[model samples]
Target: MIIDWQHHMSPRKVYEGRGGQGGVVIRDGKVTIHLKKEVYQVEKHLEFMAGAGIDACVISSSPISVDQCRMCNEYYHELGSQYPDKFFYLTPCLPLNEGAFDILDQGINEYGYKGVIISPQNAGEMLDSRRLWPFYEKMSAYNLPIFIHVSGHVLGYDAYDADYNLNIAFTREADIALNTLRLILGGVLTAFPDLTFVISHLGGGISSTLERIERYIDVRGEKFWTDCGGTPPFGAPYRENFRRLFDTLYFDMAGFEGGMNAVKCALTTIEPNRILFGTDYPYNFHTDGKDVARYIQDIRGLDLARDEINGMLGGNAATILG
Candidate 1:
């Protein structure tokens, strides 16, 4: 069974009132939106996911707020109750606000949420910045992994016109990739070595820039994102940081390209480990799971062991989510 860890459900107002993802039109960078009535509600969303063999999901909000986070978490909590083992969550967090941490703590203890998800799109400030260390410390103490997936969550940046659909789409993986790289080089990972970080969109552009980043590491002789403070690199960076995938860094298969590539890479690069199953659900599949299943069957035919497939589907998740 697949675990859709980065699914989104739109509130009716947002889904119905605005031109949803379907309405985005970009012509020479000019954006026009034709709003459509709600095409998919939670009922349709869950039904499709279930049809696709998804056993669980961690629902996150597309447009985020603390109250919105609370509502979404509560909604998922109810859904999980309805479906029993078929649903679970990475609680949406308002980590930028101090009070948000309190809400997160309550969400976990009171609701038994497994982890906390932070959207890089809507979240204005990167918590890895020094300003957010206090909150990070609390999360670290709780041993909760921080799940970040970029979404179309611009704050005051009006890249769009009247309707919010001015931007082509949000959660550009490239931006989140840069942020993830910045967080790593900026010292957040070093500071919180044990802090679990899960990136969506197959880690955005980082995969493409892997060689450049390594060169930067060799030239600067330091990791880019560090928390050691004092304005720069001190000594030789730890191999643990560079070799982070086996340590703490995780990628969820949450996009079409990203999800597919993530599985391929983990199988080859990490070799026999590190891949976690995730369908970026709530966004319906265009054709159906049949083609994708055939693709998986074809890929699986390439002489990999059954253990690898089983681990990719669930074992890796058990390790990461735990």
Candidate 2:
């Protein structure tokens, strides 16, 4: 019954690693960056997906291009063609490319992709870069939420600084928050108004900014968080911005445990209906849905109504994919 928002399938070349180790050897806790195809073979992908208990999985890619995006779009198309209803698509948004929106339109009309996913860090610049405005416009037109996912490290500063610092997760989390703020300050959210947006990795530290990034008005007089890329905190200039800002947004509980504390706090601050259930499958540290189900069980026992749990489990996502 869980509709996972973020999932990555292996490319045809994924099985080509040494002894078929799959590229990106997880060397010393560092990402070596391998060719996408060599890491995600088709057969292994379907085998991993068969019993995941998910109604549908929207596949995303790392830092691939318009061509790779096209390839993945077709790949997901084949999966959807074969499975009929189980497999879905989320075309990638090429970084800083003029053709990104064209591809988005192509994915929608040609491939029937449900939505588009852009790496918050690699998204045509940053999430806030004005260069991405065309991309946002199309999303608003389709009423689709752009799911922001990171392939590996998100921070531009220390992505390869260390062999994988313990703070890598936190770094990506901060990257999302900063990028969201950049979008806010840059007027991406306010201008589009209805272009839906979703952030994976538990929304990339977005729950922390509910007070600051107002959906409607730009708050120039708020006590903004410092971590949100030098912006002021939530206050007068950004009043109902948060209200509308949060209106069509949602987040997936991907790596729930690492940021469970933040996720719990986010639920309290934002509408419980906006939180969606997702388990980063195939790459999950825990076993499967049963293990990820614990988080939902806890939420059910919380003060939240049963209806809210239903929305988080599928309603919100179904709304997005539709």
lDDT of each: 0.59, 0.62
> How displaced is residue 243 in candidate 2, in Å?
4.6
What would the per-residue lDDT of candidate 1 be over residues 1-322, giving only the tens digit for each residue?
A: 5566666664554553343556553433435232333333666655655455556666665434566666666666777677676656667776775467766877788888778787664346753577768767888898987787764543434443444443434435555776776666667776777788777766663565666666666565543434343444224553344645333577766565333454565444344455555656545353245443543454456456888776665666777666
Q: Please give the lDDT score for candidate 1.
A: 0.59
- On residues 151-191, what C-alpha lDDT tens digit does candidate 2 reach at each position? 45444555435645534446666776676656655566767
Consecutive 10-residue window with the lowest summed lDDT within model 1: 31-40
How does each model score on TM-score?
A: 0.78, 0.78
RMSD to the true structure for each prediction, in A, is: 4.8, 4.9
Most accurate candidate by lDDT: 2
